[model samples]
Target: MTQSPYVLVLFYSRHGSVSEMAKHIARGINKVNGMEAMIRQVPDVSDTTKMASPALPENGSPYCTLEELAGCSGLAIGSPSYFGSMAAPLKHFIDQTSTLWMTGQLIDKPACGFTSASTMHGGQEQCIHSMMTPLLHHGMLWLGLPYKNKELISTQSGGTPYGASHLANSTYEISLTSDEKVLCEAQGKRLAETALKLKK
Candidate 1:
């Protein structure tokens, strides 16, 4: 049987905010017929040594593989903010994709980014851009949420034309705002639509 086309919803969430946003994005991706969402996460990296992560995480999403990353019809990558950039774990995973870049396996695929931060101004946009840079290097078409989503104009919390974002606050207790959810779904839908159009 033929495999279904999938949008890889790849993310790393230390406090769970980015993971929640990824679910919303997957919901949006599923809204497009003939497409599916594959949610994956990267393993945490330790500073002490280059110890390998466990084969599977104790809970949450499974670790992403380079093969999976290269095979996706589209991609929605997310990472929690770490000093105005993507978290170390996610960046570590992206760094291993040089082989994919060399082979042009990811070229022309549609991609988008998402991020969550502990504060409203905790550099969410920069984190999204940080995630996009590698995709751009791999020759993927980077996509952003358009202002047409409406949430981009009115969201005081985390929606941006650069990508969907979330403000989890210092306590990390906040759930996604309605505007954030809308924009995430919109980003996923737009990516799926674009990927489908390109496939034809």
Candidate 2:
């Protein structure tokens, strides 16, 4: 049996906002026929000495593997905003993909980014751009939400042409707004469609 083409929805979240966004993205990916979404997460990094995280997370998505990253038809990476950049854990995982970069395993694959920040001005766009750097080095095609989405023009919370994003408020209490959710799903569908077209 042939395996279905899948988009790897990879992300890291500290307070669950980004994780929830991943689910909505996956929903949109699945809406595309002949495509599937493979949601994965990276393990947290330690500030001190390197200590291994458990083989599996205590809950939620399993940790992503390099093999899975290489095999995906498309990619969507999400991370929480950390000082206008992606979180350390997700960046650490991306750093491990040098082998994939050397082999050109990710070259030409469509990829997009997403991020959630704790404040309206909490560096959401910056985080998305920061995440794109590694993907660009891997030679993947960068994708961003277009103004055609309409949400990009009207959303005061988190939609951006750079990618999908959400504002969690200072206390991480704000949920994804209707516009933000639409943009997230639209980004996923757009990525899936692009991947499928490229495969042909």
Candidate 3:
């Protein structure tokens, strides 16, 4: 039997906020008829001097495979902002997609980015942009939360035209603002819908 077309919601969440956003995005993708969300996570990487993640993750989604990335109808990349860019693990996974790039496997696929930050000004947009760079280089059509999302205008927390985002403000822990969740869902729905149309 054929598998349903899915939008890959791939992310790296060190502190859990980005993972929450990924779930919300997956919820939105499921709302679209005939589309599904395939949520996956990248394992943390470290240099030889540092310890690496175990072969299996301790929690959350399993590590993503290249075949899954190549087969997806759409893609959403999520990560926590790390000094104005995406976290290292996400970059590491993205860096591995050059084989897909060389094969043109992901060309024309609809794609989007999402991010979280510990502070309000912690470079959410920059992190999303950093995620987008690789997708663009892969020839994927980039999608973003449009102004029509209204959350983009009304949000006091995290939302942007470049992509979905969240302000975690974690002194103790991280969480999404209501507006951030709405925009994330909107971004997911947009990507799924566009991907369906393009698949036809």
Candidate 4:
């Protein structure tokens, strides 16, 4: 049977913030009529990752397969900020997509990024850009929240034109503020709308 069209929500979370954002994004994608969201997580990586990390996670979504990734009509990538860039484990998974790139599998697909940071100024925009570069290399069309989204102006915590974001530690916890969550949902909705338009 043919699979229904879905926007792959692929992400990595360390403190659970990014994963939560993926859920919100998926909710937004499901708002579209003919599109859906496929949530997946990348495996953790360490110096001894291959032998040290389990093939399956102890909880949450399973590791993303190349087949799921290549089949998606759209993508929403999320990661936690590490210094001023994406977390290493997510970066490692992105690096492995060379095979997909060579085959042009993701070309013309709509993609967006979201991120979480431990602080208000923890390089959130830069981290989102780090995720965007690889998607650009894969020939995917990128999407970002526009100024038209009122939350982009009223947000006191985290949300950016580059993509959805969250101040993961505002309450000494990993919750997204109201405005941040709104933007995330808006980004997902927009990505879904764009992907459906392009697929035509």
TM-scores of the candidates are 0.96, 0.96, 0.96, 0.96
The 10-residue segment with the lowest total lDDT in model 1: 44-53
lDDT of 4: 0.91
Q: Give lDDT per model, in order.
A: 0.90, 0.91, 0.90, 0.91
Off-target runs (Cα >4 Å) in candidate 1 are: 48-52
37-129: candidate 2 lDDT, tens digit per residue: 999999987896253578889999999999999999999999988889998889888988989999999999999999998777889889999
Query: Cα deviation of 29 in candidate 3 (Å)?
Result: 0.3
Q: What residue runs in model 4 are displaced by over 4 Å at the alpha carbon?
A: 49-51, 170-172
Clashes of each: 0, 0, 0, 0
Model 4 per-residue lDDT tens digits across residues 44-160: 887864524589989999899899999999999999888879988888888889999999999999999999887888999999999999999999999999999999999888899
For candidate 3, the C-alpha RMSD (Å) to the true structure equals 1.4
Candidate 2 C-alpha error for residue 114, in Å: 0.3
Point out the worst 10-residue segment of candidate 4 by lDDT: 44-53
Report clash pairs, candidate 1. Answer: none
Off by over 4 Å in 2: 49-52
Which candidate would rank higher by lDDT, 3 or 4?
4
